[model samples]
Target: MSSKVPLPAGTTLGKSFEYGIDVNLGTYDVPSWQPVRRISGFQPSPTPQTQDAQTYDDLGAPNSDVTGWSINHAFNAQVNRSITTGLYLPEIEAVLARTDPDAKGEYAVLDARWYHKPESGAANPKDAGRGFFTVATTRQNSGPNGEIEVLSITLTGKGPYDKITNPFAGWTVTAPSISSVSASSPGTNPAGTGKQVTITGLNLTGATAVTFKAIAASSFAVVSSTTIVAVLPSDVAGTVAVVVTTPAGVSAAVNYTRAA
Candidate 1:
C-alpha cells in the first residue's frame, strides 16, 4: 500500500479555523457571527497603581500603610483580522461613513463579539469579547505568488471586552399578560368618567382600545407594554367591567366602579 501524503497548507481541516466575530452597531445584540480564518494582535496588560510606603518596626510587615491599589488603565483591545474577501472592503466603508444628524456624531464604532465552536457544539454557543470597537485600520494584501487577496482590518476596543452569554437560544415570543388595573393618580377614580384609569397588566403595549363595559374610552395612551392610561368616557356612570384590547388579545374584564 502506498503511503498517504500530507495535505498542503490552507487545506480545509475539520474544526480548523472555526473562529468567528460578530459586528454590531450601537448594540451588543448580534444575530449571528461572521467567520474569520485568522485573528492576531491581542495583548492584555493590567496597569496597576499602588500606594505603599516603607514602614518601621511598628508595622508587622515592612510594606505597611498601603493606601490602595487599582488597575488604573482602561483596557484597550487591539485585534487584527485576516479576512479572505475582496467584497468586504465596501461594507466596512459604508459602516465608517455612517452619520447621525440628530446626534451630530459619526457612528463609527461597532460592537464586536467573538466566539468559537468545535464539532458537535451546542446549536447556539455563547460568544466572547463583547464590547464596542472602532475600526482603526484596514489594508488589502496579496499573496506573494498569485494567491487570493486578503482584506485586513484592525479593531480597537473602546474598553475591555466582556464575556457574555447568549440568552436568545430557544427563545419564544410570549403573549402579554394583564394582572390588574387601577387609577393613575390618587384623585382619579377607577370607576369615574373623564378620569385617567391605568390598566396595569402585561403586554399592554400597543393597546388598541380600553373599554368600560361596552363603551370605549375617550382616549388611551400606552405607557408601556405593561400599562395603559386611558381617559374614561365622559358622562358614563355606574359599575362597569373594564377591559383592554391589544394585538395579542383582549384581557379578561376587570370591574371598575364609576364614581357618580
Candidate 2:
C-alpha cells in the first residue's frame, strides 16, 4: 500500500487577524480611508428577510422566499485617548461625530470598507466589501480598580453592499529589491542580439521596467513577485548596474557583468 496521503486542493488559509476594516474620514466627494485601530473583536451579521411562498394545496414543508437582506457590522475596541495630544483615534472620532445630537448630512453617516489582507508581494489584492452605514456607540463595563475602557460600535447598513478591489492597495506596497542577476547563457557573448538574464529578489511583482547600466532593457517580464526575466540591451558591455521599477518604488541597483 502507498504511504502517501491525499492533499487538499487549496493550500492557502487565512487567519482572523488578517482581516480588517477602514472608515472614511474625509468628505464623500474626496474620501480618505484609515484603518481602525485597537479593535478586539469584529463581527458582521447578514440576515435575510423571507416571505411564505407555499400554497395550501401542495407541499409537505412551507417554502420561504428571500425578500430582502440586511447586514450589521459591529466591533469592540479599546478606547485609546492621548493624554498629551488630547486626541482620539481617527476611527473613534468618526464614530463620535455620528453620535452628535445636531449632526446632519454626511456627519450623520459614515462610509466604510472591510477587506482581507493579501499575501506579501501580491500584485493585486482582492476580496473587499464597501457600503454606507449608520453608527451606534455604547460604552462597555468600567472597572473601578484597574481595567481599560472598551467601546462597542455597531454600523447598520443603509443600502446595497458593493464588492470591490482593495481600497487601500498602497497600504501593502513595499519597494522592490534585487538580490542577484545572472545571464542564462553566461559564456555566450551578445553578437548583436540581447542576452537573457534572470533577476531574483523580493517585491518584484508588477515590474514596470528594468534598466541595465542606466540603459533600458530590450524587454522584460515579471515571472513572479520574486523573479523577473529580462533581455539585456545589445549595446551594453562590461560591468553595469541593474535596477527594477514597480508601482511602490524603484529598487536598489545590483551590479552584473556581460559575457566578454
Across 188-214, the per-residue lDDT of candidate 2 in tens digits comes to 643223778889999999876687765
Candidate 1 lDDT over 1-260, as tens digits, reads 76988789655454543444544321233122222324433332223334566657546665635343211112122233337643333234333443223322336655555544334434245543465555544434445786444435555555455656642222132334566667778765544767787778787776656767557778889988878878888755677766675533446557777764
Q: Name model 1 segments beyond 4 Å from true.
A: 1-16, 25-106, 123-127, 138-145, 166-260
lDDT of 2 at 51: 92
Per-candidate local distance difference test = 0.51, 0.75
Q: Give stretches of model 2 more than 4 Å off.
A: 1-10, 56-60, 104-106, 118-126, 168-260
Error of 1 at 189 (Å): 44
Q: How many backbone collisions does model 2 have?
A: 0
Residue 256 Cα positional deviation in candidate 2, in Å, after optimal superposition: 46
Task: Give the distance in Å from residue 156's predicted Cα in candidate 1 to where it truly belongs.
Answer: 1.2
lDDT of 2: 0.75
Write out the backbone clash pairs for model 1: 177-202, 191-257, 191-258, 204-225
Deviation in angstroms for 255 in model 1?
48
Q: Kindly give the stretch of ten consecutive residues in candidate 1 with the minimal lDDT sum.
A: 69-78
TM-score of 1: 0.34
Clashing residue pairs found in predicted model 2: none
